[model samples]
Target: MSQQTSILILDDEPIVSKRLRPSLEKKGYEVETFTSSVDALARVRERKFNIVVTDLKMEGVDGMQFLTEVKSLYPDTEVIVITGFATMATAKESFSKGVFDFLAKPFKLGEITEVIAKAEEKINNS
Candidate 1:
């Protein structure tokens, strides 16, 4: 089951991955986390992830660009944007680019889990 759903999480902070990886993996998800957008972008090009969780503000290849690329490569891949700098504009922009959801920073773990479950259902349906 874990092999069936691959998730890639990208954030500039190591702690974000540290906190998320274990929780997600414990739920039988194939989770991979990276602190560098460049590396995450490279990985995305090589393989497919069922869901992508990314931070909008990063040094290189910000979330907007990253999500755009992911949608182009795999239109069905669900993207959830998480950022400390969330705003109405960013949320609107993300939706315009076909993101699955938008969450602000410091969200509860359960919030993400619920959203991921929704994404999974959508994926299975598609």
Candidate 2:
């Protein structure tokens, strides 16, 4: 097997993380899912992930703050935002922070996979 793409998924809801972890791992990506942003941030500090998928809303350290820190630590790492409360302002703000993509909640698995494919392509090309 080839080197697997490492991904960190952060969502407050356990169901969200549970649902995504298996699918992403099945795609041959190394996956870590976190329901807590604090733990997620600590994990990121220890190692850099190739891609990060985060929810816009969370208890501590919201998605914007999380992504900002990720970019600072590893500017090349691609970030994808998934939000239940998607808004134009948030989308624009996310883009300005250099997020690779933004997705609304209740999306199909295919949608996220497609975005991951694109992010992986960019990672490879870079």
Candidate 3:
């Protein structure tokens, strides 16, 4: 919390978390990852994060639902939605619900990094 750079990564795939954690940590973010939305929600309730990056296609609470919950519970927390099933509908829905950014799957690491940078800026300003 306190507006320092920290990221919470919510992805069911171990591979995604594995690839992303080191890069974001190297950039100086305090990082936490969860493969379960239930557990992530508990963590979110207990602590404030600079950003929350969640996969859109999860087994329990999918990304869209997660986005809604995040905004409702932690309105100031920036939420980035990432999905392999990228579509116009999903993009529109995410924006309508106030997602910070949307990233289609197969996106380069730099692209996600840019989104994280933007989130940091927003957090700092707020």
Each model's C-alpha lDDT?
Answer: 0.93, 0.95, 0.88
Scored against the true structure, residue 45 in model 1 reaches a CA lDDT of 97
Clashing pairs in 3: none
Rank the candidate models, highest TM-score first.
Answer: 2, 1, 3
Deviation (Å) of 113 in candidate 2:
0.8
Over 4 Å off, model 2 = none
Candidate 2: the clashing residue pairs are: none
Scanning candidate 3 in windows of ten residues, the lowest lDDT window is 1-10
lDDT (Cα, tens digit) per residue for candidate 3, span 30-115: 99999998888888888878799998888987878877888888888899999988999999999898889999999889999999
* Cα deviation of 121, candidate 3, in Å: 1.0
Listed in order, each prediction's TM-score against the native is: 0.96, 0.97, 0.92
Residue 52 lDDT (model 3):
93
Q: In the order shown, what is each candidate's alpha-carbon RMSD?
A: 1.2, 0.8, 1.8
Between candidates 1 and 2, name the one with more favorable TM-score. 2
Candidate 3 Cα lDDT to native: 0.88
